[model samples]
Target: MRVSSYVIGAPLSDERFYLLLHGIRGTLDKVPARTGAFLVENRGKPLVSPPWDSDDRARAHLTERGYLTDLPEENERQLLVEVATALHDAALALRPPSFFFVPAYTCNLRCPYCFQPHEMHAGRGVYAKIMSHEQVDDAFRVIDHFDRPGALAEHLDLSQEGQGTADSGSVRRGALGLFGGEPLQEQTRDVIGHIARRAAERGATLRAVTNAVQLDLFTDLLGPDGLAELQITLDGMSDLHDRRRVGPRFRKTFQRIVDNIDLALARGARVMVRVNVDRSNADELARMNAFFLERGWGSHRAFSAEAAVVTGDAGRETLVTRPELVEVLDTIRADQESCLASYEGYAHGVLSRALSGRYPFTQVANCGAETGMLMFDPRGDVYSCWDEVGFAEHRVGTYHGGTLHLDHEAARAWLSRFPGAIDQCSRCPYALIHTSGCAKQARDNTGSLFAAACEGFQSYFPRTLATIYEQVESCLLGEAERPGPRPPTRTLPIVDVTHGRTRPPRDEVLR
Candidate 1:
């Protein structure tokens, strides 16, 4: 019997449940085998338990709950139409192309994991030139290409509506982000000013990512309203951090950063702290969260820290093993739950397991490159993401030499290769969700995207499941042993990975 959709009203009895189950199978038999596989494989079993004895048992449970149904064939067509409609709605919600402007390439410190290692060697004595006023105009020309076509149509619509001639869709300005060597550097103010002014004229919001050292200097560019969001980097607490991110005033630098953040917060400007997690600093992540909580910043805004498995030039063989990293993530999750109400324990746990090689399908699916967060270099060179920095072909465009362009089609084509690029991932059940894996890691380690994903899954999956089990067990123990007030949470400060590799010269050090 051909079925489309099923509807059930009122409370379900065992008898009704079984009837519905049989009907669903009858209808589903006509559906594709792949659909059957997906239902049976991915979302079939609860992670908390072993597999059910039989499909009958599963079906019975579903039917008893009144969740299972067999729909008429016509209803299936309607369901498809609804799904397509929802997809179209979602597509329309996404922001259109704005621009990420990188004004300089010089940074203050030599970070060990920084993709641009050459910049460190160049040292503080060398200043990377900021864009000239003429260059600023040229950059605007690029921005105009994206904004004007849509803006002109939008203007026409606004005029028509005002005059009662026509009704048109509302057009809101998009976002523009500033990048660096260190964008807050003294020299780049003009570049920032120019962009901020143009953004104001076009009704766009200006955002910036800075190290926060020279954030105060940009107050003029921020104007009375200030930036939409300012992202700052803080690796860890002072002692641990100063050891890694060594400079003339390491202690004062971080203190000033925190001070600046407090000032920004008081003024109604958004401040986000971006902590880059690596093997060395992974253990301290929970402590960092606790530190934030003490300062009252954890609850006021979004507090998040990301784990990045070192890749490209920085991904050495001796870094934290996949299993070790999973352990660190579990600790992070547990710590985060103390203060944050909406902690993603299970999801991140799953990701950790995938990263550790416990889950078969836990491969890298959506690298930032494919997800539209493209990286830009000091000279306007485009890369897929931060890690895949050196590839010649991936350079989609550049601003130098009077040629500035982006091949959107080419970019899409490159991203499309992420799935089915690796053999193990292609055959794995989770391939669709994860895609192939981290292309930069794959290329760096195994020299093949497929190999990298497969290896990562092998390492991440088992450990992740084990970690989850342990966490659950710990919770049970806590309930049984000392169930009073929970212990206070601690936030570990970020430790910069690039400081104190060598002693300062005699002349540079104070007696």
Candidate 2:
């Protein structure tokens, strides 16, 4: 017998309180200094009860708190297999899969760092066809197909006790995401409007991932309650944004986007302005935040600004990481004399589970890429995720004849990716929490289906935890930090992008 692979030790606020951070499978224990020492001393080692030969009350206390457990190798194996199967099943039984509809594959801006080129014709090897009404029909047909009676009752929280199926009244949430080339384009307004009206009728919310270039044109369609969130990207300031998001200079793209943002805000739609950053534009982000503050956009309840790391184009995004962006933000915050309490009134929400349990999702594996989520392109091709948006090889199915022709082999591979399924993650400290990173990114980078891609969970996550909790402690104590010496910044070391330590076997990877 050995210790269970589910325990993390960290201070909640300071050295006085140590968090015995067990995840959803177990409970969290806030122990004192002595109890924390006992747990840390015995962690990952064979457990011994109190008063066996030595009178170790701390060990008994920790065990009683559920931080200490016995796990045999055989039992662990069997448990993993069952949990993986349960997770896979839960995928099929969740709220209606998120529908990411691509109206067109042609973009108005020609960002040099853009990964997916604007495919105008077949010669480009990418589908650039504007989605026909038939494609729209096919998308709805697929969505309807997944909404079997009593299917999502167990997975999504909105479903009733015995009601498994989602109907027009119970669709509480079948998230509708509008993606590029540009969903708000003039030509695609009819298709976008159709989706919005359908979502509204079905009691679902529609969130648009748009360029915000022509959002004003569709203000009539973006009814106050219909459009939930507008995820628009702004590089930095006007000149920096114009240089990065290259478009017709005569068009006044910057001012137009700002005006469109105001239109969405006026309509009560949450405006999520993702400030795309790289080494070049990283420094400019603080200026953008200042600009928003100067314009009083900070006071708007639905307005938010966040630093989003650019992933697709490496040449365009040199030295881009979330920490680097945060450093620049911190530097600017000091310069601008903004405090944590000052930020509380500003309308922006960062997805953090430590602060609020509710954000994007609360699960071992948050994304629906493998199970319920599916995307449809202009060419009627079905994909498991948005990362594989423009890639043809990753197409899992095709939407022809208003029917989804799926590839079971490809679908099952993604479905198998969970905490228990991946052999490498069995030993990971935060396996149950982090789950797998981008599956496509892992496979593309490491040529393995089971390789762990991002190491932020192990690398920067602890530091980030301290940073957040420390601020919370400070804010709670009502201690306004007087500017003297700037606090030292700790950055994460880069992990190997090629592959994680273990590849597992092909059978396990494809299982």
How high is the CA lDDT of each candidate model? 0.44, 0.57
> Which residue runs does candidate 2 get wrong by more than 4 Å?
1-4, 11-18, 23-26, 29-55, 72-88, 118-126, 148-173, 200-205, 248-252, 323-361, 471-511
lDDT by residue for model 2 over 1-511, one digit each (tens)? 3445555665554677665554324344566755555555565667655223264675665556446666664565556445544544554454445567888776666665665654541214455477777778778876766654333222333233443454544443544777766677777878877777777776676777677887888887664467677767677778877776765432447877888888888887877565656778877766787777777676666665555456543563274654454456657765774311111110111213434554322344425565555678888788775556667788877887777777767765666566666776665555555556657667777887677755345544443444444565576678965331122110111111111011111111100
Q: Which candidate has the highest lDDT of all? A: 2
- Tens digit of lDDT per residue, candidate 1, span 351-428? 334434453222232443432333445545665444333344666555544335556554544343444444444334
TM-score for candidate 2: 0.77
Query: Where does candidate 2 clash, by residue pair?
Result: 150-164, 150-165, 151-164
- Segments in model 1 whose C-alpha atoms lie over 4 Å from true places: 1-95, 120-127, 147-172, 220-226, 248-252, 302-312, 315-318, 321-323, 332-368, 371-380, 388-394, 400-403, 406-412, 418-424, 446-511
TM-score per prediction, in order, is 0.61, 0.77
lDDT score, candidate 1, position 187:
69
> Which whole-number lDDT from 0 to 100 does residue 385 have in model 1?
46
